[model samples]
Target: MTQAAMPQVLIVDDDRAMRASLVALLEAAGWRVEAVSRASRVAETLVTFAADVILSDVRMPGMSGLDLLATLQEAFNPPVVLISAHGDIPMAVKAIQDGAYSFVEKPCEPRRLLTILRHAADQHRMRRDTASLRRRLTQISGLDRMLLGQTPGIADLREQVLDVADSDAAVLLVGETGTGKERVARALHDLGRNPAGPFLALNCATLQPAVFEAEFFGVEGGQVGKLLAAEGGTLFLDEIGACPLPVQSKLLRVIEDKQVTPLGATRPVPLSFRVVSATNEDPDAAQSDGRLRPDFLFRVNTFVLALPTLRQRRADLALLMTHFLEEFASVYETVVPELTQDDMAALLAHDWPGNVRELRNVAERRILSARRGGGSVAAAMHKDHELDDVPDTLREAVAAFERELIGKAIRAHAGRMDAVAEALGIGRRTLNEKIVKLGLDKGALL
Candidate 1:
């Protein structure tokens, strides 16, 4: 089997001869190897190496293999194979109980060692993939907590996203510039089966055609292309309307056959990944204008999500503005500034051809307009721009008001929740409920 995407192995042994021998053997077998001297140094080396499986001798001078396994138990430890010169039935059983992958005795057969090590690497890949997928899912789930607003367009888009997130079919995201096509792609990926798999994206409009093939199919210089790197995951082609006609043919082949031949390689590399393409302009117009090929269009048009423009979701503007304010405030480390009515009207009146991205740029400018050194920047902020803090989603609006009320209550009652609830004239149950719902566990006062 080709070792292009094989798991990495780390070998640890105090013996210099043994370390050199193991390194040569693994390298000959088309495996990546990192050799370290002692058990204690494994953790520090792993910080940089990130081994899929560890092979170490049990009877080390300072720290034993069992000790190393115990130390790494709480962390995301890779599968470990412990080798020993004095290994017995009792020692082997003890090693297994201590989480060793296999306990091989000294003078181990090369074939047996290879078999056990490869199996250990396989287990490590599965565990690591699962953990990575879980993390991606959690991150996407948090981003969708409010999803900015409850407009019909937004609601429909969310439903559409869920309906098609699980499929491996090609997805064409059509939208106005800055309508968050990439965000939709990521949501689909996070919800897909291979959430932990690689996500490789290329901007078709930006790539130089002369260099596109080498970049896409990779060169002898070890510059792996998106197709190979994103195996078992998703490959996103951004600005698909600008894709070159020559590249278009090969892209279709890969999409249809799930395989790619590198620039300098003879044989084709097998690839299995979901294709998600996006274009800011109308795909039909592109095809008619000869910018996009008809067959290419048909192949990639398995599913399409037409993202709504900012104008179509004007009802979500106030809440979107609030989300941006909170987000930018956290980013720029500034006090959340106020927006006067004029600012609101200015924002609403504009056609916003550039969509939500344009509004985000305006929000950033609003935050930057306020005086940075002082605390009373909010009062000075609204004088220039007529913009005010307006929460977009129901969750966000409720959270904003809840934060203000609880903050005021805390200040009035000297940070005592019981006293604050009584002073606010609300029951303790209601106050606690609001606190928990608004994510106020570690509030400014408490």
Candidate 2:
């Protein structure tokens, strides 16, 4: 362990000689020690040296050791041992009641004092470790479970989320399609300041220009707007860039003012809720194209959290695949199929344009197919390829068409790469590489 990791004790005594003696004794006893001549100075000393245990003289000038113990109890949880010549049975009992870990009489035996300090330090270390473990457990079962991955991008993203989750700031989630933007949005809400409060989600893309205002702001009827309904909680607006231009301006006003007015009402209702908005479009391009309002974008993007693409975090692919397989296997009550080397190679080579959502769907399909008696992960992946959105450009169209042909040929040839290659008029090596590149797994071909 480093020097900082060593057991540390802060000694507070008004007697100059006693302070020096105690410091020397503790240092000799294999403990890092800092001695202060006053109880008031203990707090300042603690700023630099975080003592695991505080050993202080009960009688001090300004703040008594008891007073320091009281203050430290509220600020931090380090164990405090109080010692004084005036220590009586009643005073010791009262000190313990006031949260001192232990009380010792002065003219104390060095061996016994060291023993008490050792116990105090150990107790403090245990308490700190337990608190840290509890926090890790909370993250594992809650937020980390939802956003599962070991990639640096994902780890950084989790750190960022935890940092801002407790604040009342508006957050913007930027990502590509199927990158779990909504999951991230929900995480921001559930892990936020008001987990128990309402979490209202609205898709701006589905909103029509005519009814968008009335629906969002609420009419003169009994219906309350999302802003009002999400009081003390969160309102997640997905596809925020797709919101009509005029409504975006009004949304910005509501956010900035922390109030909102219904379409038919004259009075503005006080609004209070964290706005967590998401968009797949590039903010700069959207703003330049006039699809997203600049002022509205800036207002919502107080903390812009850019999510990593599936391609960017390919290292987490196997972990995510296993997670999805286990989840879907339990749902379908089937044995999880083990992926062959070829199948894994195919998975690694494929350009996962659809991201995690696509991977999850493939896993579900594989599980369902397994329950039906016989199917391959490769086949499920082939299905995913076919189900991909229509290609927009000539290059993509050609690639998609070529991938489909190769998939059909492999299935027809019964997993024989040689026959498939011969049938396609391509070399065996070319066929193998293409199969891997296309994510058409060997099991599916077989």
Candidate 3:
């Protein structure tokens, strides 16, 4: 099994010797194990370990396992198993009632302990997977199609957006280019208190310094500003970091005073709308470099949501690729072509500097190219643009280079396995194994 597929356990106990013994026992049983002397550290360790089952002693220095159970109840935590020599019927009953998966007294049989842990871990994983499936179903059923992906980062972002959507606070979205900050901002508006109200968007970088206030505040009687236009709704400001200093001051005043004075009007107009701002640049850096005013940044950034880049969530690539491929194929009135293993390998190998937007474009290009009877998806991906030199890992870089070299060799040899193997100085069987391992489409090459 892969490292991610391995069952994981976290042991929390005050006794160092007991922790060591449990770690050894679990590791011997083909389970990944981590142990901590304090129950309090379990939460901190869990941030990275993601244990399927928490095997903790009943008593510890700072916090008892019972107390830990109480805290874990607040979040989506793994099943916890409490163990202690002092365990009794009353304590066991209390632990079970408090959401402990199972209770074991001191000197648990090796086989029994393993069996219980296995069951608990399996159940925890099943429940988590079920919840994730339900969440995806909800997304596809109209929660918001734009904020897609089942990766932990995206899932956490979805939860955060839902949590703050109804509130009328100003939110600042932070992410790299093409990470879909605008989509997130739109989701916030659509799910907010005034979905029926107008959702106005503005790009600060597109507005000249002289026209910024006029566009935001509007002329006296000529036209209404975006703030007024977005009454009872949301005003999304993209590239807020690029807002001019003068306009930032005025914007801050409007946000603070809850009103704005028209460019040629003396009277101030009352405004009621949430501000959802997005910036591809760093706010701190922008402020330091004088591109953004500190007061304006503080005013607009009531809450901040940071979006993850594509490389950070590669696990969701298959789902995202499928979604885009089918979507574009349907739009273009073409059959959904099956992506060969080589296509998948190429998709995974990309650095995706343009994030999800780049993936969507590539998928569309694949459908369009196939409509005109063009080459493979892998070939189409690199037809226009050179491969990004920076790979996320050495392994990925080497694998990608190997895939390219072998693909060229197969084309040169006309897909004759023996000829290709001879040209590459490897046995035919070994070459075939590499073809399968690297996910090359030999038939497509021919």
Candidate 4:
């Protein structure tokens, strides 16, 4: 069945007549409707009914509809159209600012109210379908455990991970902060045959010098360190460059001997696990500076995987954006709104110094803020001049403009690549190539 025919609306009003009327009107209009009398039970009812739009009375006994709206705003972001008997323009304005979909008076025009509800419901369904499709695609793609990316740099890294996963050799992953180094390590562990064994991880930077030895080698009280905890699996040491020289020496000894000497213990414990370490610093420079031992570096550098920065793999930006959009939409219970060409342009023009993590934050903010304002995010972004500024060079300017326009079109059409291409008066293959050349994903723009 088509999405519009499947939308569900929740009617929250104390008056039985109003609730019945809303249910009848919505059902007759080809929408699924559920009627409820109490605001206190809205949350439970929402979960049970899986509402797409919430039509609620502003003032009610026990808990006011405004109170219910505020409470449900966080858990469920369905568009709420408020109805009030005693209209207060200021209160309605405040409600819109606080994320209400729209506000209407009690002596409401049936046609106008129904039209507004239909638009809101349609938008909600679109967002819900987008999110649902993303989740299903992620599962079907079978890349949930492996960080998904199609860039050449990421592909190379994945190949290296697979190669190293087959051996018992130690590996060192190097990358900037928030580059998913730990995720790479986990992927390595999973790819190996011994995945059933414990995969233990600890951040060396967070551990104090005094506890470093005890943490890595265990203690007299029979407490096992991360190394021992991974027995036959993998031990991941995050931020290994931050380890003190003294602690480094002890770790080096364990790597070489395949045994750890626990603190306050006379005997050494035999370890059979593999070691995988990650650092954001340059290992060669650190070794030359006496911060890291050259021998230790060689021991752990049996294999090395260096992750590229976000800008270096700009081709994956759109894919990452879509991934984050789906994630945030599910978490916030909001519809995934379409992006404008200008919004896409801004995203492409901005230098993402913080990488994927930063992009996720921006997408989340845009989605939530747009819903609260009762407007399309793309419309708001179009007003920003930064999206229109052309660069100095013709090639650079054209590329920048194309990226922005394409990005915006995809967003505007809710990531429908065909629709975006048609809107921009371009062929599908040409649009696909442009997206690739611009370092974006067609799906992401959608």
Candidate 5:
């Protein structure tokens, strides 16, 4: 079947008759119409209906149409043409600055209004399309993939990523566990010039303390260490603060001399890789504790990228949710689940200690579980054992249960960190830290 090409316009007015008349006129002009008499309900209506233009009366009871226009400007950019019975040119000009697309006097010139609506719709379509393209480009740039956030803190981090990616400066990514330090490291490698070169990653914490030196400096059998393996590429050392004191000295030598001497071998292997290290611990504290050498810290700290906790970027929940939904849908071969405003509200309300990684897990689980007839993501989320019963007197137990519930939700959402964060009423970054602290395996969510 051929889809209709009519553009949709939402008419908001206090008068039912006026709204009906305007709808009729617009429909006659080969446009699709949705009319809402109450300004208070326009926000909810817009959430469900896709519209090209909005025709709103400037004055209305309860909440003025102007107020609605202001709210819509932040959520979505739709061309809004204000209609005023008592038209004031100055007020209209002010409304334009406040984001109204245009203003028209009421008392009905059907032809003129249609012409204006068409023009406004065209302009809105162009702007929306452009914004969509920019979002796609941002995603393609792998900026969105670094971590989910639209806050100023996140914006600053993104700028740092771009700046540091342009050079070969060694970077130290500082953040709490589960804050996606490794993801940021990968983003740097992907955005850098030698992306095609080997992108090697190793978690310093995963290596046994006894074998730290042998593992990092390579062993005798001619086995190359992670640093040497990433020659002409990127070497990402996660939990760098976890490296043993003795190994720290060896790493410092490699960074200063640009070479690595394998254990039980005299000759040093030339290092030609860009190093990006991550740590959940404070660099200065680690140095004072003798867990990290100050010289090594200075060498790797040529650039520093500190990831913000999820709570700091709550405004980005919707954007991150949308991005993760699309990602999980492709992975599971299912259509993306539609999220209601309440769902989004719940997500924005919670404090996520887990960060972006936790959000991804939750989204993936929700998609898969919902597809299998489990129920809504929010409902399925509550079924986890951790959220099932509350135990009194054990604050630590309660905290642990909360973490478990958050983790289960992430798993059920299929690794969509934003969706899981929303379902659990927590911030994505907060949830990330909790996941790390609780040692939740995101692989379960996938």
Candidate 6:
């Protein structure tokens, strides 16, 4: 492995000699090590070093190792092994209960310590990946108010996605069409333990049962199926509710056995992959209608995430409007049109029955028409309908749009100040100053 790829460890001890000794032990094992003589800087160290495993002495000045563990848990909690003395067994037990990965006794055995460190390092890698994906989810969807907004529903969904991304559990994402269910599945895959592994996605609705056996289970001629293609990664089955009952049985068997039997072949091929499925319809209704098997449903959605429709998350429409405006304008090489107060009200009040996809199309149309100097977006949106009494001035409307625009840019880039600043065409210092002045929340990224 390259030097950068090597596992990085952080050692915390007040005693210089002990700290140096621990650092040598880890470095000798081909691991990169950073040793500190204080627990107060543990948080700073984790961020700066991006350490894979933290080996800290339980007895320390200021905050104890246990206290550091608690503090870190509130943030990006790593796998911490408290190096406790012989008499600190009770304290070690309490530390483990409080969410420390494991504890090692002092006068540590080199072999035992290395074993613990390796395990901790592996877990640390998993958490690191999931955490990165969690951040990217915000960044990629930053302008996407429904998924990356400050609304309670979006906040709840973000938490659920982060919580389940690292696990091997089967996930079922349920939502209306255009609600970005596939995006959630991809996040789970990207944030999974084996992110480097191949991610294979298939639409169950497009599966033709007659040839699906070959498509899913592979042919006897040595063609690999979707199941095998996703080995060591994730297989996302979208619109799973549309799958035929016969296919559902086979899917259940594959999931249960964690193996696949290719067509015209008897012996099964053992495989390792995570399953994340999604549907636009209600799962219970599908089950009742015999479109989905109860056993299959139970096996697939061990962790279910229900996505809200665009109408439910209407608070983000204006932001999404502005975002899509920038999006299509750049695509078609047209200028982004301004949204008057009447336009904003009409867009917000109109229930987007078609959800995000419909809104996107609407934005594209608006941008195209405005490019040809045809008409305003508001006129087109409210062509057949009556306009609401929107009393806000042009300045107020511009300020509101700008706020959401900045907030979305902040979130979409995972709160990386440099990237956010670059995207906004501003300097880092100016962005920080603006955030303070505008009262924008930067905590979500951190």
lDDT of each: 0.79, 0.82, 0.84, 0.78, 0.77, 0.79
Which clashing pairs does model 3 show? none
Candidate 6 residues 1-446, lDDT tens each?
89878988899899898988887888898899998888998878877787888888888889888888887775556688888774376777798899888888878899899989887887667545535534544476422433555557777888888899889999999988988888788778777798799988888888887877788789777787767888899989999999888888888899999998898888888988899999999999999998899999999989999988888887767666777777788898977676654566678778777777778777887886676455566655653342243327977666665566578777778888799888777899988887886678888544
TM-score of each: 0.52, 0.56, 0.56, 0.53, 0.57, 0.52
What's the residue-level lDDT of 304 in candidate 6?
91
Q: What are the runs in model 5 whose C-alpha is more than 4 Å off?
A: 1-140, 144-149, 219-222, 380-446
Q: Tens-digit lDDT track for model 2 on 123-217?
A: 67755643444344345667778898778999999999999998888899999999999999889888887899999888887767676667767
**Which candidate wins on lDDT?**
3
| Best candidate according to TM-score | 5
Residue 47 CA displacement from its true place in model 5, Å: 17
Clashing residue pair totals per candidate (backbone < 3 A): 7, 0, 0, 9, 45, 2
Candidate 1 C-alpha lDDT tens digits along 239-315: 99998888888788888888877788888888899999999999999999999999999988899999999999997
Scanning candidate 6 in windows of ten residues, the lowest lDDT window is 382-391
Residue 407, candidate 5: alpha-carbon lDDT: 64
Error of 6 at 155 (Å): 1.6
| Per-residue lDDT value at 367 in model 3 | 85
lDDT of 3 by residue, 174-273 (tens): 9999899988998999889889988989888777768766877888988777678888889888999877777777778888888888888999999988
Q: What is the lDDT of residue 345 in candidate 2?
A: 68
